[model samples]
Target: MMSDENKVGTYPFVAEPFHVDFMERLTMGVLGNHLLNCAGFHAAERGFGIATLNENHYTWVLSRLAIEMEEMPRAYEKFSVQTWVENVYRLFTDRNFAILNQEGKPIGYARSIWAMISMETRKPADLLTLHGGSITDYVCQKDCPIAKPGRIKVEEQQALDEYKIRYSDIDLNGHVNSVKYIEHILDLFPMEWFRQKTVKRFEVAYVAESYYGDTLSFYRQQISENEFDIEVKKNGQEVVVRSKVIFN
Candidate 1:
């Protein structure tokens, strides 16, 4: 049982009022943030964390993420985020997460792909070469049922909105924070839409990085009444990210 601690980690959190939307349900943006923090916590505890890798001029970058939620915790509700490594490859790793309600019932699950990169060259690092490939020791068979992030194409010729990346969007990596893109995509919808429906699933694939002062153009295509595909381009040409949002 003790070995499982090295394989999985569960961190508790509450759906504070500030973390919830006007409907008193936890917002996806905040939930996404918490999920990422759990990833950092799990990795750090296992010695492959960014802080440790940074010492060797290496860092972790998120490549793709997919989150599926059956329900969002309400305000002041107690919940927890559980994370575990699913697989470790040469240059990328698969991580999974579960959001449990107060009763320990899973309300959501997520699957993410990450890569370790050299900060100097900004190139992918060999995961099998790191820490003598001990990262494989943390792999768990625990199930994450959500589908992996799929190809999100937004061929819409019309841009719905445009903005310039600012300091607030930039992270320590000198690029836009992952969650910020989630926030911006959600912003594309009005309260009226959210009032009538709730998000059922969210997925994002980071194709490239966008730095501060870069202009972002948001293009969206409605796949269905409840499904939408979004693409974000830097300088209106280079795709920084693509996303899919499904509502219920």
Candidate 2:
């Protein structure tokens, strides 16, 4: 078995005041970005980071993600995110994370699925043979309490919002940034909704890519008073992504 240090990567962070919301807690979008960054840092240290893969015209893509948090760090609080590879498959892998408070106790957790794909052909690559099969060594048995991303289906509901993808919404891959969707989905509700409650969980699954100039139509279905399922379609036809949000 690999040593614990080899199986996991822990990185620290600070909840800057500017990144917090009116409630004085780190915003969901910022937390999502932090989680992605931790995934990058963890993968890079283990030899399969985007930097290394990009050299060969390959990159990691997020397939699905589910984040559950009891609470986010308050403004000016010091925290840390620890990430580990939970399982490795031929063409995909499962990665997990733990969000620790200032005192090193876990306050939240996340589960994610990723696939390494060739940037040129947009095809997934086999993980079993990468780096001479060294990827298997990083797989750990760490427990990630959050459930995997669930199925989100929104039918022909009236569109709640419409957005045109712009320069700022694009990521390095020339597609709408993943975290940007979360930000946009949250805007569908009124400020009163945010001011009155906290977000307890969020889940997103990428279906297809949405490019610049694509007009995205957002549809929402309320699962309950505090939970909702959202779907984003490009140009009123192609489904690009689906998500779920639950509030306290």
Candidate 3:
């Protein structure tokens, strides 16, 4: 049996035309989706994926994510993503990912925090107790280049847009998927902003879960000429997610 500590998953993907923006470079949201897909595939192959967790009436939820990049891959560019579990703490697990260009050189990296929650209770489960044995034997010595995403202070701002959760936004957990939150935030920005600036870093903190038919309000604050803060809230009260985008 393969020890969880020794497992590493690598996924190769191409930035198709659809994955790129008007600038023909990969969009931040698409990169987020790819990173998440890599994590899901890695977990599923290790026998601790959604299917196995579902059998136990549990599911994994992303709590926080941060990504930093030197540049975005252009359309039709082939790249590879390597992911591994860094450590499994009491209630949360740390995972890291490396993004390699076609030539296999590091172009970007991401770190994510996740927790296992009961399907019925929707409360976090102690990962150590649930997984049987210690899975942190081979923790990655290297740390993520960027700091973890933190909570954003909501400022007085008018709603930028409104979106009603739909079937496409819901995931297997019966709530809006984490990646969808990034997409919604990106959509609030005009296409011209994407073409004019390149995102150097992106961070998101999942504050709360949202369900289908729920309406979400988007708000934005310009921290600086090249930095912006975004937030999504439910019914103008409960915050669903908060994000920061820094451009170069």
Candidate 3 global CA lDDT score: 0.84
Global local distance difference test of model 1:
0.92
> What is residue 110's positional error in candidate 1, in angstroms?
0.4
Model 1 lDDT per residue over 43-159, tens place? 999898989999989988999999999999999999999999999999899999999999999999999999999999988999998889878889888988888888887889899
In the range 149-228, model 2's lDDT, one tens digit per residue, is: 88888874799899999999999878999999988988888888877898899999989999999999999999899999
lDDT of 2 at 234: 96
The per-model lDDT (C-alpha) reads 0.92, 0.91, 0.84
> lDDT by residue for model 3 over 141-218, one digit each (tens)?
554576666667759479989999999999876889888888898888788887777888888989898999999999
Q: Please give me the total number of clashing residue pairs in predicted model 3.
A: 0
Question: Considering every candidate listed, which one attains the maximal lDDT?
Answer: 1
Model 1 regions lying over 4 Å from their true place:
none
Q: Clashing residue pairs in candidate 3, if any? A: none
